[model samples]
Target: MLEIQFFQKIEFLQHRLVAVKKSVMVKTRKVFKNLSCLTVISYKFKGENIMKRCAIVTADLQNAAANKHAARIKAVEAFLPEHTEFLNKMRAKGIPVVHLQQIYDPNDPRKYKHTDYDKKFIEGSHEAAILDEVCQESDIIVQKHRDSGFYDNNLHDVLQAMNVEVVILTGMQSQICVQTTAADATFRGYEVLVPSDGVSATKPEDTERALDWMQKYVGTVKTQKEIYDDVLAGELIGGKHT
Candidate 1:
């Protein structure tokens, strides 16, 4: 009886010690991990102040106007002047902007019935480059081969790394790239928004339908000014800005 009690006491004491050791190790590991993230961010991004948990994701707004699709050019161009001004305002608020550009690849997410001849979006073409006016030094550029910015690209990974929760979708071809990217963002667990005034399409009806479709499956569609006010007020869809 005495021997049995001694062995049981030894086992109990061992279990207690093991649990205490694990608790200490867990706390130490959490501290180390936080320190690691701080070190990496401090070293990599020197002076740029990163506002946590939100970003502006813009789809193809490439230059080399002559090489663009005529219909897309005709429609999207009408909103460029306004879009440009909105983008500048958004970036001024310490919001990180990610520019998604499509480069030619045979396996692009969407199959185009149109020819690729004289296309500005082909790889190695300046026509595929971002327009100079909206370009900023702090912008993160993600080159993609697909219609959705998330398709075969580092966009999601980059956003996750930045700890982003809300993604504001902006850019050209309301029914195509903008719509597709927003859908992908929804599927990938982002709180998505499309400023109605920030996008354009080949026709007014197309843009309207795309906006309706996006609101149903992807996100809310609001005017840029409305979105900007909400952003400033910190009342985004998913949660308040931190």
Candidate 2:
């Protein structure tokens, strides 16, 4: 009887130990599950708060040479509303806007290219300045030579400093500066968005051709309204207002 009682005691202790081990495993799994939930919540919160990395590049919107071109005037007249709204909205959203001016410096190798055109935006000419109506005080100015705004300008540096991975472009001479800049941005591994109504050239057909080329090989061509909605939704490069 003594031996039997001793065995029963051993069995009872073994069962108790098994119950304790099972309880520990259950608690461990619960802790791990809670930790996973916390991690997911943290990730979502971080994403929600992070701002988007994008910049707006407005190329060659200066009044100088633009004033001499009848086609440019007509093109701009049709889309001024879109340009105005987009510029103001970008400013309100605190997006960095780069205003590109084509200042044909006399010493530039490309100066010969502009000899046939009207004289304006000649390096330091007041006419080289962007239109007062479209410009806000917060805008950054980048004076460039030739058709591309990136030529001899601080555009790349500015974009890099802002950590911009996307460039939203608008402004004059769609077939020249705007289109060329869009292609260059794509070559540099940046996604570009060109609003169809936001960019213009001396000729409407020329502008459309440039837009088509960008859509095919350079960037995404969207309407101003679509761009505004996406920007508001935080679907573009950086974060939007919460």
Candidate 3:
């Protein structure tokens, strides 16, 4: 009887040990499952949120023919065809194209009150329209009344939604609209790339000054061909801006 009782106690302890081992294994599996889920979430948050790395922002390239800034318009027009080809290549690579249109209200207090210059840019005026040579119906258009494209406009939101980490800024009036836009873009945390030949000013000195300022404090200044080649070779998209 004593031997049987001792054997029975040993059997009970063995059964308890097996049950405890099973319980530990279950808890371990649960912990590992939770860890696996967290790993997936981490990857998605870092990798999938930013779908695109670059966008082309053309600011205030409105009706060139009616524009009074003859010298600036002439400079921009010279490179329009080449710029359009660069845009085409960027578009083919699935980069977003954004055009900024400057529209002024005749009665708005912020408009230029001294000259009739603002009159041509009034809403629905021919001079306020974006150029057809560079803009397509499918492209995104952001209208603003100020020199800065981001001033009280949805441009930032649009770029955020597109996950654009870098902006290829191009347009008219290098020292005014383009410069302001580039500054704003830098403030908003987007890497800006201004093509030297893609933007213009009424005078060559003004253009040089704006480019130098932007390069020193705001963003990089490269030629249209250099930027186009990088875009085509996928170098810009891969976080290689130099």
Candidate 4:
């Protein structure tokens, strides 16, 4: 009778140990599965909410022709007051704003004999200097030699350092400088925003074509008022515009 009782006790002990082991295994597997699911969710959220930097590019607003041309200059002038207001608001909000100015160097090695028209517009020429009235001391200025602001310029570096994700373009000669810059920005994977009223070209048709192309291929096109409203409403991130 004593031997039978001991054997029975051993069996009961063995069964309880086996049951505990199974429970532990099941709990471990469940925990590992939950961890894997959480990792995937975290990765998806990070990918979707990636932050981007913002900047404004102002092209050559120098010569009288750019400021006085009936269609080009007049259009820009009409929107100047509101544009300035929006820029000021952006500045107050701590958004990065960059102004691109074209500088012509007569002795530049890159200057080609075939481009006489370009040669004549030397650095000190009326066409090269940024318009005095429109440019402000607070604005950050970058100089470029060619139609594209990115060509042999510090634009890329500046934007990179600032972590710029989007560029707001405004300037003269929409068909040339503005278009080239917008295309380059898109190629670099930066969002581009062009305010139709903030830019001008030598001709209405040319400006229209450039704007249309940018809107279709490069980035979004919005009016000055829309931008201003966004800023005022605090829709933009970073900081509020002053």
Candidate 5:
């Protein structure tokens, strides 16, 4: 009878050990499953949180009726209202707006005899100064020496500080200053958006050609109305106010 009782005790102890081992195995599997699920959730959340950057680049819009043709001035004047509205909307949304003013130094080594009319105008007279009517006190102004705003300018640094990833280009001489800046921005890995109505050239044909080229290579060309609507819809980089 004593021997039988001892064997029964040994059998009961073995059964308890087996049950504990099974419980540990089940808990370990559950922990591994939870860790895998957390890893996937982390990746999905990161993918959905990517942010975008945006800015506006305006060229010198000075009054030069005598230097430029009367027709050119008329074109610029016609576009002013629309441009102002667009800029105001951008400002309201807290988007960065950069105005590029052309400046020239008589003694600067970069000046050349056959430089473009835009460059020559800056080098020669007061017409290079940005037109006061278009520039507001609140706008950020950047002075540029060449066609491209980035050339010898702190535009890139400023954009970097602002975390700008996309540039919405506008201003005078669509085929020259605007195009040059857009191309340079593209080369520098920035997305560019040129509103068809926000920019104008010396002639309609020039403007069309520039837009075509930009659409083909440099950046996306959109209409001002489209962008404004996007702004209103709260679909742009900055949240919509109205």
Candidate 6:
């Protein structure tokens, strides 16, 4: 009878050890699950809060000098250095830079209707390529056939994914692609900032008119210098000036 009691006690102790091991495994899993959730939350918060919620959107910085838009190329090149410097600074701050490139689809029947100069911009052509001065391997490239970068494209989605709140417009043809994009961005509830010196047109008057229109309806119009100042002052994204 004593031997029986000893064996029974041993069995009870073994059962208790198994139960304790199961409980420890369950608690460990719960702790790890909670830690995983916390890590994701922390990463999201850092992306949306700690970093600037602003992006630089450049339109059509291509080799347009060989096309009918040669004047547009010249106009953009004049301020290209300033835009490049601003892009570098923004990149250093972890701000996103999106480049809009006009690439004509050669497979489309519409290609037959375009002028030879326009044909030079067909996909894989030299003229269709983004300018080396402003193009970066790390920058997001959005190939477009329409004037507006957001037209039937994923540009808006890209911005939304980055949690961008404000968009600074730059590049050639201020009266066309830039203006249209500004309007679209406004419609999508993004604050627009057009740098007066950063955009250009075929003529000086067109640039001025586009800037005025954008200021009245789309968003604010400021020079690159002024905008950079705002960035330095912590006013680019969610600060007082934004």
Q: Give each model a TM-score.
A: 0.69, 0.73, 0.71, 0.66, 0.69, 0.71
What are the lDDT scores of the predictions, listed in order?
0.68, 0.70, 0.70, 0.65, 0.68, 0.71
Give the per-residue Cα lDDT of candidate 5 at 97: 79
Tens digits of per-residue lDDT, candidate 2, 1-242, equal 00000001112454432111111112243543434221111111222434356788998777775576676677777877778888888778677788887876666655456564535667677777788878888788887876877876788887887788778999878888898899788777677889998998778889988887776555679997887787788765442222
Model 1, residue 167: C-alpha shift (Å) = 1.0
Query: Per-residue lDDT for 22-46 in model 3, tens only?
Result: 1111234355343422111111122
* Worst 10-residue lDDT window, candidate 2: 1-10
Give the per-residue lDDT digits (tens) of candidate 6, residues 1-242: 00000001112354432111111112243543443221110112212323357889999888863245567556666777888887887776566789898876656567454777667777776788888878788788888878888987898888888778789998878999999999899888887899998887778899898897787566779988787777776756521121
Candidate 4 accuracy as lDDT: 0.65
> Over 4 Å off in model 4, which ranges?
1-52, 64-76, 107-121, 124-127, 233-235, 238-242
Residue pairs with backbone atoms closer than 3 Å in model 4 (clashes): 53-165, 92-241, 92-242, 93-240, 93-241
Residue pairs of candidate 1 with colliding backbone atoms:
none
Model 3's TM-score against the true structure: 0.71
lDDT of 4 by residue, 1-242 (tens): 00000001112354432111111112243543434221111111222343445777788766644555467667667656666666777777777677787765666777363365555446567776666665667667788877888998898887777777678888777899999999888777677788898887667788798887786556678987776565556544442133
Top candidate, metric lDDT: 6
- 129-220, model 5: which lDDT tens digit per residue? 55665566767778787789899889888777777877889987899999999988877878788999999876888999889877755677
Q: What is the lDDT of residue 32 in candidate 4?
A: 38
Q: Judged by TM-score relative to the true structure, which candidate is superior, 1 or 6?
A: 6
Q: Identify the superior model by lDDT, candidate 1 or candidate 4.
A: 1
* Count of residue pairs whose backbone atoms collide, per candidate: 0, 4, 0, 5, 0, 0
The window of 10 residues in a row where model 1 has the poorest summed lDDT is 1-10
**Model 2, which residues run further than 4 Å from truth?**
1-51, 114-118, 237-242
